[model samples]
Target chain A: MAVPEVLLQSGVSSLLNSINSVIQSLGVSVLLPIIIFLIALAFRVDVLKAARSSILIGIGFIGINLVIGLFSENISPLAQQMVEVTGITLPAVDVGWPAAAAIAFGIAELGVWMIPLFVAMNLVLFAIGFTYTLNVDIWNYWHFAFIGGLVYMSTNNWLYSVAVGLTLGLFVLVAADWTQPAVEETFDTPGISIPHGTSAPYAVAAIPIHWAVDKTPLGNIEADPDAIQDRFGILGEPIFVGLAIGLVIGIAAYSNALFVAESWYAILTAGISFAAVMHILPMMVGILMEGLTPLSESIRNFMTSRFEDRDMAIGLDSAILIGHESVIASSLLIVPIAIVMSIILPGNDVLWGIDLATFPFFFALMVPIMNGNIVKMVVTGTILLIPLHYISSAVAPLLTQAAGSAGFDLAGRGLITSPVADAGSPATGVLALIPAPVALAVGLVIVLGIWVALRMWPQRMYMVAGASEEKARETVERRHTGKGGGLLPNKLGSSADVTAAEGRSDD
Target chain B: MTTKNILVVCGTSVATSTVVKEALKEKLPERGLDIGTIAKAKATEAPGKVSSGNFDLIVTTTQLNQDKFDIPVIHTTAFMTGIGQDEVLDDIAAALED
Candidate 1:
């Protein structure tokens, strides 16, 4: 009887192990879609729509994996050869945000919980009047997951990861509130605030920098946005940028074999391959967004219906601000500067790649804070890129670890990091260093204090940030009256005045 | 019926533009518009795409220098915030008809 019982137990244990292995083999491509499907159904989305969107998400993941495979296969060898030939020790591949987003969502343990966690947090905050900004930009929720995944990778503690992720979410909401006046003034998008993880944190850093620059002779120098756009606009084009970098790196790597026909073929292929990666990766992400749209719309409807009558700001992606001429000019100027700095900046091992096209996002809020001063925006951006390199290098190992766990085939590839959202983030980099418990404590205090302060003196904060008395009063009055802001007919009717206001606000 | 090509532009081609594109795909056909390919590009790449592609209407969620393009540029964040979306759809339909 005892022998038969032992045999039965062993058989059951083996069966369970097989099931676990099978689930693991399915990977994020299949699993993430399952998770999304469940979430959409829970949100009461139509069954057919839920299935379709979730499958698109699965397809998006598969498409992203294919692109990363191609990108790494080509770029990894070139990066290795370049390091060998040029004697530059920069081995960290900047895989850009597309891969970063996939890795963030691939963490099954944490990714499954991120949507519910943030949505609950937003609902709670809005209920308590702790936050007036309803963050409906569910697609970018990957930022929090990325940070949480990093903490989880390091500490192996889920609790700590949750704490840090929630802390960052609160901090971003407050940053959005603090920058709302400037964002609205600069972008001419009233009633909208950018609580974007990549863009908002930079605005906090820029306020002091903008202030310091104003005290110097550099404050008076203004660069013409039209001239900069006309002169350096080609630099902003991804195909050109990719081809140029690929050719430069290819030539440098194959310098010893320049006479060989094979070397030139490799060089030219590298150029076109990179351009394809730049152009195609975002297109894949668009498909990912297509899958996400139904769910995102459901969440937005859920949140807005709950708070329809409240006076609040709608949080959105920073993409809305990038069309400003100053943003276009400053970002164009920063692309070359970033490349040069990546090579020369000491203690930096990150080889800047795909995220170079994302310079516009980094400068979006900063341009507004600097009051569209192209010179100041460029100067501050160059100065900030120094710390950005060091932070990216510091976090590259953890990012690589997270990517591996996400089932990215980083087998022979060296360490990888993203410049814009992953390593370059001050919030993620700084919080990652401290012991998780201590970091959680500090983060809570800071976020809570900022939220309370912003809630109490919404307009005072704007005034302190340099809004004129009249403008501040007008903002407060607008908030009180609940009249012209946030999807109102009166606001839409003043389109001509808003256009005229854009001209006056730029100077 | 000739399919009208529409170009959607935003900061990142992947972010807001995708949102706008999905909204258009769902809403355009309901309004009796023959939608062709809805191409997406970053705001900085808008000019190159416009000059190269035969687009009948331009819709953007961000500010574009409308002066640079002859096409009627419908710049609005309505699709993103789910506000005044019908009005913007009406505008797009009207522009495509012209």
Candidate 2:
């Protein structure tokens, strides 16, 4: 039902006006939020040091990409050209360099591809493992990228992508340490520190060939199951395969979508989404560059930095988990949201534009949920789909069609397809659209759910955390026993201190 | 009394950086930090300005490419905004005794 014009309303026009004024007044000082954030993290903000590092890494990566963009429009082409110069290529027949990078970017951004990929990869791996009876089971390499895709792709969003990359990078690093088996285990270097210098070695790989090789040999191997398991479990090969398939299909559809010959919005949205993905996960080139060198030290440092602040790291972990769940649940609401949007889209088609990309992306996320209770997700998806057609049908006619039988523009009724103005107007630039009250609310639910999930960890993790502190205590203790250990006496503490530190979110 | 000052900087110093700086000022004092100059720190002058005599430390989410720095510089993750605020303050407070 249309909102009755009498009761219906638009955002306070003054508020919009003031926002524009504020944007103007801030001058370029507006850049300070992220800038100050970096500076604050560098100089003032006292926690989540590793997360700070992740942000820097991501921002730095993007900054570089922006510079690279200065020279080229499509990053994939540049990535591919780099490969030809290197004289190497990824062997995966069906999936090539451009597609791989695009797939990585897609998975990292969308969180949708993994749904189908997860199912298919698992089935194929086990079936092959079961059929071949192979001990070197054909699975488990995608510790970060897979999860990046499963969690980040589908939605194909930026905030979530950065959030996921940082959270995942930090978690893998910390979890790598926390979950690493004790001295009793065979491999007891204690710290599988992935040295510093390189940032998110896995996610940021620009070359496709380097992408797979970095993981294939396992240079910095650690002894553990939880992290390794969780890492692989969430992402696994299912995601890679899924994204690979999705791209072929998505690209084809996207190509078709390009031709749908509708408005610029559809084409623009798909183009932007696809382009963003390619930059993130450039294909075979990264794989070709693969090999272990002195880079381990940098890798270890990067990982350690990733988990520098115990407090903020956990909080971010909490946030990512929430974002994940939000992606899951909000995904369920996809159809409903789309239904509502379609109504608004068509009538206002010529007049204004909403960031409707979220709708189709959300629809894509349901692929996993679709597998669960296929009927429910499908019903939800359709309910969402019907609205697009509804609004399109309703609005198209209003702009050009007569107002006879449908009564879409009736007097007693509220605004129909053609409302007077866009609610989200003055929303120029990607920045303007971000902090989307709507997206944030959904993110909050994800956070609430993550807090609930944090409780489910086994008591052993508490033991592990205790063990961690005791281990640190031992280092501190040994330091006292000899030299440097006692040096930071004021700084170091025992298992209790570590646990206390871990529990507090205040960094 | 030495002002436990910090310089928050980023490219353009626009919106997100401001939110981050304000958040720092609001929270830093409680941690025994005498917060000052939460203004825009230009990327070009970021290190030279921050590492000079005034501020005790530099906390930033932006990536700085310098090989070495005079003062302790913490780079925050853009992905994790306001994440390292408290720890950053504490580290600076720890640095004051030096």
Q: Write the per-residue lDDT of candidate 2 for residues A1-507, one digit (tens) a residue.
A: 556543344446666778767654542212222332343343333445434433433343333233223213332332233234443221111111122122232232222222223323323422322110011100111222332432332344555544443333333233322222221121122222211101112111112222233345332332332233234332222223233323332343344344565523533443454434333332122221111101211222333343343211111111111112222333333423443443354332221111121221222222222222233433444443433343333333222211111111122221212111111111011111233344344443533333222222312232332234345455333222332211122222223343355676444
- For candidate 2, what is the DockQ? 0.02
lDDT of 1 by residue, A212-330 (tens): 87799999998799887978665669888888888888998899899999999999999998899998899888888899999999999988899787777889999988989998888
TM-score, each model?
0.91, 0.24
What are the root-mean-square deviations of the candidates from the true structure over C-alphas? 6.1, 22.1
Which residue runs of candidate 1 sit more than 4 Å off their true CA positions? A1-19, A455-457, A463-468, A478-507
True contacts kept of 2: 0.01
Candidate 1 backbone collisions, by pair: none
**Chain A TM-score of each model, in the order shown?**
0.90, 0.23
| Poorly placed runs, candidate 2 (over 4 Å) | A1-68, A71-78, A90-314, A317-507, B1-5, B8-20, B25-98
